[model samples]
Target: MEIIVTPTAEHLELDAARLNSHPQNESRLFPDGEVYVQLESVADIESALVVHSGQPCPNQGLAYLYGLLDLLTKHDVLITLCFTYVPYGMQDKSFYPGTVNYARALLDHVTRYPVRQVYAIDPHFSHRDWVAEYPVSHLHAFPLVQQRVNADLDDYVVVGPDLGAVERFGIPSYEKTRNGAYEVELEGGLDIEGRNVLVFDDLIETGGTMVAAYDRLKSQGADTVVAAAVHGVLDEGIQRVQGTYDGLYLTNTIETDAGNVATESLVQTALE
Candidate 1:
């Protein structure tokens, strides 16, 4: 059985190639008895299944996805659509009035295609049931991120930028207080002091919040500060705080020129 991977700017080919080596009963239905094909902007088809990682930006648009759908439909091939949500910062719930339901709207738009399955890493949804509109697969990136952090760091406390993340990420986190600007408070007014801190979130847009968190952790006597997210959307402010934190780990859910402090080692495990 062969597995073909579609190419995007993201460095997922190595991991995909690794996933191809393992055989599954699901491969029996493929044409020529081969199960994998990879689709990329550059034509280096190494697997039996075609995987296309076309740019989905508005300018580039969904033309590639549409084309792939047409090809799959014509050939009667079952296709799975896999993507992550860092490029577009998905705040599942609206914080203020007149804000758009970005996550739900995006899913609705993407599901309009004829893909059989949808795979997502670390979505910002409040509940899994919110994605029930589409009859496809959705994978959470939190457990994967947690596993990576847990493997790398011991004697560490999880830090959340705010209370929202504490609930969303399902971990104990320190809330950044408005007054101190560089202070994070734990439950019962306890502050994280002299402890190794691991800050986890779904995405990092600019480095503002993260940088502030780093300072706050330092002020509170956190021995070291490490920030990890599923997506690294280093926008304009990233330059200001690139070196502020000790380590910034992220997954290859989006394409970015900004190098990650660490790449997720749990890619292989997540596939399982």
Candidate 2:
């Protein structure tokens, strides 16, 4: 038997229903904020697949993942970990004195487990190339973004929130926009007047950067500004400035209470 586990209830909701037919596992939190996982049943599981949508609760997903891995290890089952929104992917490098490379730290921690493979969907990596003992796949959501943008394309241009996003998207030539605490700046001198613009990135958290970009695009006379991201962690900042965006699109990389575009087929592609 193959067992599929979701780290939390939110994750279980995001996972495909076909996978849900099997026994499900749940995690509970003690009053002290400690996590304890309850595996329903796995008497004779041959392999395991973990499908986890991220959480705002810091390290909660990781703790739950480790717990599942421990159980699978005891069963000597091959395991595959699929994290729709990889935690700490933004902290891929050391930025200041005594600061740890959290991205690497996360990878190292998971590598210690008997995980046969790992999928970090739409990861924000400092480097494209990596070598790990087990297979580590960096899946992209560009196709999904492209589909969303294709529905209506007229006088449209793909935009990047920053220079790095521009480089990653690799659109031959595009408008450049940057976000600052107080304001945003548009560079590259591409005229956006009366143009429909589509901005995309790997993830959107807090949305301060997207808000800045959206505001600047409108000021430059952009006809319409739509934003899309692989992971939608639209926190307080987005909540505060929801009306600033013309249309907001997000993938199911992370499960939230809000309605988001489904990403199950895209995830299935990675699994196959």
Candidate 3:
């Protein structure tokens, strides 16, 4: 299938049209040639993705869904919504007071049309088995994320911002730190006094935890602190750390204005 991708000033643009000649749909074919045509458009595709749900804050996953919907609507494609939930994240339980039924509500909304499956990436609760109610496709991201990390780094310590992330990240070499905070430690807890450090996480929101990690690493004698995440959810008031760290990297799973971050090129390449 041929795909065309466009980028709006503030959103994702997708237009897809089938280009194969068919006997039944002669009207869609070019007069001089024999190419069938279909059109699909999508805007802001990165907004609704939610890879992580703890530590920093909630990155709005709805925006990513909106963009996906736009593309699916145009192409008449069907998919299952996929996500991951941290152990103590708000979406973990429905028993908590005032907690929203995120799974149900999200499924209800997405299934309104052509969604054929629903997937969760290592959801916290065993009861998450209920997600199968709508033809679900539950999957895990740890293996994928681990594969990516293995390809990127030869030897690096995995640092979790807090206890919750320690379990969620599930890296055997993971180290836990305070919530929304960070600390630097050298060999044997001694100060590094001047070294480079790499910190990785699943999501970043409000820039609090990341910023705190940066500060802690610097204080522990690290000369530079570089951070990376799968999702960059720079909520309002948290964008102030745009250029503060040595390097802040994130995927295009969510749109942000931070420099030096990277996004998946699938959509872009598909358009070309």
Give the candidates in order of lDDT, highest first: 2, 1, 3
Error of 3 at 249 (Å): 0.4
Off by over 4 Å in 1: 1-10, 14-61, 86-100, 126-129, 142-152, 174-190, 235-241, 257-272
Q: Model 2, range 1-272, lDDT digits (tens) per residue?
A: 24364544255333432212222333266657777765646546777667666556547867877777787788787777777777878787788999987877787888788887788777787344443444688677778767776776765888777666855666522344435543455555447799898877777776766776777778789898888777766566445335677776777676664425666665565556
User: Model 3, range 1-272, lDDT digits (tens) per residue?
Assistant: 33322111122233432222345654533466433333322232322221222223232234333444555566555333334332233354477787776756656666785655444434444245555566544344334454555565554455544344555554322233434333322222324356555566666656666666566666667665566665554554235345666655554444455423333333333122
lDDT score of residue 4 within candidate 2:
62
TM-score of each candidate structure, all chains considered together: 0.66, 0.83, 0.51
Better of 1 and 2 by TM-score: 2
Worst 10 residues of 2 by lDDT: 16-25
List runs of model 2 lying over 4 Å from the truth.
Answer: 1-3, 9-27, 126-134, 152-155, 172-186
lDDT, model 2: 0.66
The TM-score between candidate 3 and the true structure equals 0.51
